[model samples]
Target: MKLSHALAALIIAWFAVFGRIQAVTLEVNQGNSTCIKAELTASFSITYNTSNSTRTVQVPLPDSATVDAGSSSCGLDGNTPWLVAVFGPGHALGLSFSTNGSLYSVANLTLQYNLSDTSVFPEANSSDVVTVVSSSVGIWAPINTTYRCLSSATFGVGGVTVTFSNMRLEAYMPGNDLSPAESVCMADQASTTAPPTTTTSATTTVTPAPTPPGTPERGVYSVNNTNGTACLLAQMGLQLNVSYFSQSQNKTIQELVNVTPNLTSSSGSCEASSATLILTEGRATTLTFTFTLNSTSNKYHLSALTLLANWSDMTAPLSASNTSLNYLRSTKGRSYMCNTEQTLAVVPSFSLNTFKLQVQPFEVTTNQFATAEECQMDQDQMLIPIIVGAALAGLVLIVLIAYLIGRKRSHAGYQTI
Candidate 1:
């Protein structure tokens, strides 16, 4: 019985080690300084074929994979930089980086694989090379801070599906490892069940049914002062509307897009009397909000907003600025809440819906959201029904008086009718 138990225990331990997906840590450097250091878990779903059947395979990035950041590794201080990781003989992953002023992000993903490697793809009769490319993965952050997305983000391109999770990366920093206080995580990056696409023959193609989009990406974004006192807190679904010139249509076009958490980089900071939140969409768009505290009123309000959008077709970027808006007013110790679904239009190009939104800015005590002040719009909505009820009561009173007077007149001496 003891020997049998030992065998079983060893079997269980082996499975425990091999069952989990492998994670890899990578670092890219520019000469003596580290440009990017990341630890991520990756999984791939690949489709291949044999003489008589089409089969699918699921593979994880191996633990032996290593990033190449040697003498021929990086673009250094160029406008665009890049890095690569070789997992096997012919399997590799590549990333291209882009910088915009003070921010940088991974702009593209390139994955290459070979079918002749039976270790990755079993029972593959033919040798074929597959390459998958995707753009605008949109993992970005400010310089020196780490970019993180612990939730899984899946990307599908052509016949390949890749899922990356538990990712942490810092780019263009002089330091060796990640920083603690400045790390920013991309919010609401929940993974989706991506279906696989396959091919039966050279000319024919079979595509998987596309998954419906999931819930709107929303997160509790906050900022704290240097001394660790909370100062700004916001929760809302952010959206942007912009008008641009379409070169193909030869006309102007207006479009509305969600400021998705997965594709947008967000950051916040606070001072003694002011706070700001910055959101950027890769290198093409940026939105900023500034809030100020009024000590006399003991309230804080959104004081200014700015937006800059750059598209390749336009000769110049679109810019908009507004000041003294005095929006989202709340006491220093309270937050603003609007339970009803209402959209607050900050400018013609920017708006947000207050669905399950409670926000406080400029002062936060005890590290907790204080009492919530109902929005003025919700207050007005509540008053509408009360006003209608009062009007109906008045009309009923008038009708009752008229009926009583008519009865009294008819009963006088019993013959007036």
Candidate 2:
């Protein structure tokens, strides 16, 4: 019995140390539109480059990865969330979590990234891809990739699988994720500006600057929220950098720092069951949102909206002149507006609400996820193999003990004969 116990213990220890871990399956939903929803297991890693004063987050499938685990919604697996990010602290906090496909070679700070599933409120899960439009700049652990500009930015590569031709490159500054004035450069841009005297007949060649460390992005954005009264608005400063990345050290960069008429204005209110924000800035502005869900389409729609807004930046260190800039712009004359309309959809889903937004309009959405610490090992997972090994070891020990005793008796019988 003692020998059996000893053998069992050895087997238990062997499997515990050497057993292989397997991948767990997750659900993927693409719905009818191209907006993708899928799940995959990912290991979170953070590294800080003391040399460059930057932090690097590498969350791609590990080097040991064999395949993308494959999802049916899209043919192959490894569908990185439309965005990948990691949030940390300081002016560099939010930029730490950005669109480098989990390789955050920008920003300097500790890291954390979370977003609630749009459909489900607080129920969260780890995902391969996350969506965002903000970023930082600095060289990371190892820089790679060549720079290339998209032929066009408006029709960004969007689908289940993300490829060079079918993917998008966006950049933003640290602060609010959905600031109307916060520029998010997702489109291909003209390579260079021509002087009026040097005008040409053909179109301007379109090539981006580069996407290395990264570039700041500026512009406007709005999202319909599941919580009707939670919606808010923001007008950011003009003159921001943008980035476009594909692979390795090469990247495309640009800037909209010269925002025409740089400053603008806005005002926001949340009452009854709805929240409204009137902005006169950047490219697109004017937002009227519903506080309830659409009965026909499980999505929320903007009951009233227009494209107008003041251009301002909230992340700039507050100074006497800047602190009250937004307020001054809001009280401007003519209710400033432009002709072109924005086509972006403000699909109602999950949203972040805060007291700070009660007076202003800037917020973010986060993910809900099963954390690494919370994962439990099922008895059936590795225990089955462990137990089988123990039983085999114990049986061998019993047979060996029996054999020794029998041999001793045979030797004693020979001596008696």
- Best candidate (score: lDDT): 1
- Tens-digit per-residue lDDT, 168-265, candidate 1: 87677667778663533323321323246564657844444334333356656767677776677777666555555555444455555566666777
- TM-scores of the candidates are 0.43, 0.20
Candidate 2 per-residue lDDT, tens place, 46-69, comes to 332333364433232222222121
TM-score for predicted model 1 compared with the true structure = 0.43
lDDT of 1 at 107: 56
Regions more than 4 Å wrong, model 2: 1-44, 47-72, 75-223, 227-230, 241-417
